[model samples]
Every structure is written in structure tokens, then in C-alpha cells.
Target: MILANVTLSGCTGANSALCAGAGEGHLGGGSYRTSLTPTGNLIVAVCLGFIGTFGLTNNLLVLMLFCRYKMLRSPINLLLINISISDLLVCVLGTPFSFAASTQGRWLIGERGCMWYGFANSLFGIVSLISLAVLSYERYSTMMAPTEADSSNYYKVYLGIALSWVYSLVWTLPPLFGWSHYGPEGPGTTCSVDWTTRTANNISYIICLFVFCLVVPFLVIVFCYGKLLCAIRQVREINASVSRKREQHVLLMVMVMVICYLFCWLPYGIMALLATFGPPELVTPEASIIPSVLAKTSTVINPVIYVFMNKQFYSCFHALMCCETPRRGSSLKSSSKAIRAVTGPRRSNDFLFMVASLGQPAATVPQLGPSFEPTIDITKGPSSDINNPVVVSLVAHYDG
Candidate 1:
């Protein structure tokens, strides 16, 4: 009879709860079964699968590049490495469970599983945000005050990474400490923070997360980057030769990364805030699903951005993957030629002449001076010249 119902539900595009609750229906209310539908489960599976696969592959590529290339192992790249590691965790551990819950439309993994999933997801997300803030500050210091930027020591980088982990723990630890609970919601049966059941606790937690993770970090990044841009502009005005094109490229890259970050996570933040403070009727299943998907989307987009927008990262990744050696001789010659080409024929004459001279081999010539060996007695204080024979040795003898 249950098999018949499962088949019928599949045919009607019914919720996944039909299959998900087959064995675990004893734990929750029978009403939970209504949330399961075949169509919804399929959607969850497809979305999560796509996100998990792409995010994992991209982050893995980045990790390989960082490990293989010594040049890419800067302090800034370290932060990126940390971010990729966290994102990869989400892709491998968090997203698969989420997909399963969505398809099942019931808490098949149960209460324990829900808490673990939530903690992992929240931990990685928070870490990624903190890393972004660290990267912004690092760039600002390097560009605005090069001397002050000398503080980017090994200990300092380790400290920043430690702080990121601490921040993640602060947000993730609350639910486990009895401040919140997780459960199934909507027609998808996916588990999340039980905002509807424990409104105040959920509100408090989400507000804290927003303040620490989003609001404060966003402010820090914007302020630092803004000051950096202004400082660069000032230098450019003082001397036209002080062109900061490299710094500008980095700033643009950071801006694009932050903008993408905002797009991916903002909707989730808005939804969380609304669920907490807005009218209860606004927390519809359909509405909640939008943010859930957006949050997952954020994890997937970061790897793509890192791979495509970061030139150094892309080059390093290509070298690692393709096993291609960097061309030294050709690159140097080409670069010199380019400079000459840009500086016109007059400048090219001197530079090309230099290049030609460097291509010739060196030859050793014989010495042109006569040589004579010299001898000295222990008691002698001076010696005569061999060529002139005018000078005579002077000796002092002492009686013992």
C-alpha cells in the first residue's frame, strides 16, 4: 500500500516526504508527510549537486595552484587559500546533506544531523567573510603605507587565520549551546533554524550573525579600500610617473569579488532579517526557499570568481594543471622588445645595441707585464729592485 502511494506521488510530482518519511514517520507529526513531493526533491537534488560539484572542483584547483607555485604563496594568497578550503568544506559536506533533506522533505538525518549540517554551513560561511575582510585590510596596508605593510609577518598571517576560525566558532556554537533548534520546514522537508517555533532565539542569533559577519566586516572592507584608492590618487597627482595601475587592478578585482559576495549573500541576509522582524505571514515556504538557494549559490560563485578574475591565480593554476614551465629567455626578450617598440626608433637603437652586445662570447687575453720572483732573508729589512738595481737591501744583524 505504501509502495503504491510512493509511485502515485512520483507520478503526480508530489513532495519528497513520501519517500523520506517511509521509515522515520514515527518521530514527527503525520502532517510532516504532506510536505514531501517528488518534484521538489528533484529540484533540490539538481541544484545541490550542481553547486557541490562546481564549488569543489574550482576550490580544489585553487588549492593545487597555491601549493605548487612558490610565487603565488604571498600573504594575500594565504587568505584566499583559507577561503577556498572553507568553501570546499561546504561543497563536500554541507551541500550534499542539504540536497538530501530537500529531496526527502523530512528530517531523515534527524535532529543530530541537522545540528551538524547547520554548524558546518554557518562556520564556513562566516570564515569566508572574515577572510575577505582580512584580504581588504592587507591590500589597503600594502598600497597606502608600504612601510607599515611590513607587518605582514608569518605570525600576523597565522593570527588572522586563527581569528577567522574563532569568529566562525562564535556564530556556530550558539545553537549547540541550546540557544536555537533545527527542524524541517516548507514542503521540501529540509532542516534549518526553527525560526517560526522559537522566534526570539532565532532573531537574536541571526542579528548577531549579521552584525559580526556582514555589517562590521562590510564596513571595514569598504573603509580600508576607500582610503587606499584616495591615497593612490594623491600619489598619482603629485607625480604623473607614479602610475598605480597594478594597485588599480587589485582594487578592481577586490571590488568585483565584494560585489559578487554581496549579490550572493544579501538575499539570504534580507530573508533572515525579515523572518525575524517582519510579519509572521511573510515567512512563507516559497519565500524562505529563495534565500536558502541564494545562500548555496554564494558558495558556488566564489570559486568561479577566483578562477576567472585573478590573473596570478589563473596563471599559477594553468602552470600546475598543464605542467608548463615559465618561459624566461623568450619572455625577457619579448618584454625588452616591447619596451623598445613603445619608446620609438631613437630609444630602440641603444637598447637593441645592448642586446646585440650581450649575445657575444667573452675571450681571455694574456698579461702584458714581466714578472720576477722575490726572495727574502729573515734578518733583511729591505730588498733591491731587479729592474733598476739601484736600490739595495738593508739588513740588521742581532747577536744572540
Candidate 2:
């Protein structure tokens, strides 16, 4: 709880006034010194403000979408809501304080405030990471067992959600109990795990945190998605009904999510490790700021990639805002019936549910006119499942 008012070594000129005793770069209670100028502080403030505003807005909209649409309440999607809540909490409890401190060019809140900021952000962020891992595994398991009646049972989903939070708590609580510490981080405007403290107490915690929190979750995501892709490829070979374009779309979505997760978090993780294990001066205060900013940017990028890109959600969102009722179609029911008729009751259910998981049936799934009758397309050739009405319909539904 020691507050340092150490002066910067190279500060001069008008910037010197801002750097004057206890004026700037002075974390209220920490050993670290910030080398940021007033201009740097202003830039940090602007970034935090932008992230806070958009993150709050987007996450709230996602919450609203979940509440307004019954279809969105599927067991798997509940995990998405869990992620949004954590991101929203970061926007609410973490971002604003950092924004205010950045504007003032120092940590405004006292030692207790710094502790809370560090602990809360760590808790919420880890929860999001664990939840994403669980989400990927859930998607994989659900797809693999699509034939199971309770493949996506709420009990299992809720158990996963609870475990994610509990696991995050196990990692985050140690700092408070003195396994490590939370103190002013980059430029003295934010706070996090005491990366600069090279003591065994701090170093042990950082190593464990990196392994359990970052590396494990990332590996889980990669493995589950890899298997999911392989399974989809297998299904495509066995059933020509599956759309290649839709498979590509699913692959793109998976890649975007994984890439975004890595892009946002990897630098911050590497920086922390460097600060912990490398030479004392290896990571500059100015250099540390970028990774912190990138980590927070995840709060903004998540909703766009995870929820907004979903076609069913996109159409419903448009309908909700534009005051146009979403188009009605019995295609989903008929499609299911046709699939059941062809594959029989037991096997067809899995295919239908797999399609739903791949992507929900959009409003654009074609409706059959009363005069129309199901017919095999001879021109589609022997290899094409286009001859099967069920397969033809499935492709159209997926193309949405």
C-alpha cells in the first residue's frame, strides 16, 4: 500500500509541469513509475472512453436480443449471454475508472480502488476466457451427439457456466490473500497482477496464471474447433445435403473468433511474462500501454464477431429495429419433416439439430407454394444430393 511520487528521469519543458511532484505518472499506491506524458495520458483516456461507450452499448444490445427473442434462448446460447455479462461488467466497473485516471495522468483512486480494479477486471476477464473455452467444447459435444435428445440440456449448460466462474475465482482470489498482488499497471492509469515484482510470491502467481488461465483455455478452444471442423468435413462427405458454402461460413466464424481472442489477449500475456521474467527494464511503461489497450478492445470486438454476424440474429435485429415483421415460413418444419421422412425418425433428428447448430434456419429459408410438389432433380447428377428434396432444402436453408 505504498504510494510513490517518483519523478520521471527524462521529463522536461512544459511536460515537466505535468510531471511535477505527485502530479502525473504517480500511481496512488505502487512501486511502478509511469513514463507517459500528458499527451499519452490523453490518448489513453480517449481509447478508454471509446471502448467503454461502445462496449456498454453493444453488450446491452446483446442482452436485449437474448431477452426479446425466444429462439435465442437455446441452451448453447445461454453461454453467450454469460460472456456478454462479463464484458458488460468490465465496461461498467473497469473501463470508466481507467478512463478517468488516464485523463488526469495518474491513478485517481487510492490503494483500495486500485485493488478492486485489478481484481474485478481479472475475475471478469478470466471468466470470459473460461466461458469461451466451455462454449467451444459445448459446440463440439453438441454437434457430435446431435442424435441425443438432451445433447444441449440446460443442466449441462448451467453447470459449464457455473464452473467457468468458479474456476476464474480460484485463480483471481490468491492475489488478495497475498499469493501475489494487484497494483498500478501501465502508465499508472490501470492496475493488474504485479508483473514487475520479481519476488517468488509474484513470479509464481504469474506463471500459474499464464499457464492455467491463458494457455489452457486457448488450447481447449483450438482443439474443440479443430475437431468440430473435422467432423463437419466428415459429414459433408457422407451427406451431400450439407452446403459447402455454409461449411466455409462456419469455418470463417470459428477462425474469426479464435483469431480475435489471440489478437486481443496474446500480446498482453507475452508482455506480462516479459515483465515478470526478463530484465527489470525490458518492458517500457509506454510499450506496456499498447497491450493493455488491445486487451480492453476485446470488450468492443466480442459482440460484433460473436453475435452480430449470426444471420438469424442479424435478421431478427433488423426486424426489431425497422418495425418490419420478420417474414414467416413453414420451411423449417417442412424441412425437418422431409429429413425425417428420408432418414427415418432416429437419425434425422441429429441431422436436423446439427443444421440448427451450424446456423439456425433464417427467415429466408424458402417456403413451398401449395402447387409445388417435391421432385428429384435429374440434372443434379448421381453424386449430387440435389436430387433429394431434403438435401436441396437443407442447402437453401444453410445458404442463408
For lDDT, the strongest prediction is 2
Q: What's the residue-level lDDT of 227 in candidate 1?
A: 68
Q: Model 2, residue 195: displacement in angstroms?
A: 0.5
TM per prediction: 0.69, 0.76
lDDT of 2 by residue, 1-400 (tens): 1112235674465224434533432443532234478888888889999999999999999999778876566676688889899999999999998888888766667667888999999999999999989988776665444232242358988999999999999999999998988877756778888887667887888899999999999999999878766655544655545446445756897899889999999999999988878876577777888999899998899888867775445655777899865433311111111221112223222222222112223332345554333231111111112222222312211221
Error of 2 at 86 (Å): 0.2
- After superposing candidate 2 on the true structure, give the runs of residues whose Cα lies further than 4 Å from its correct spot: 1-34, 146-152, 238-242, 327-400
Q: Assess candidate 2 and give its TM-score to the true structure.
A: 0.76
RMSD of each: 18.5, 9.0
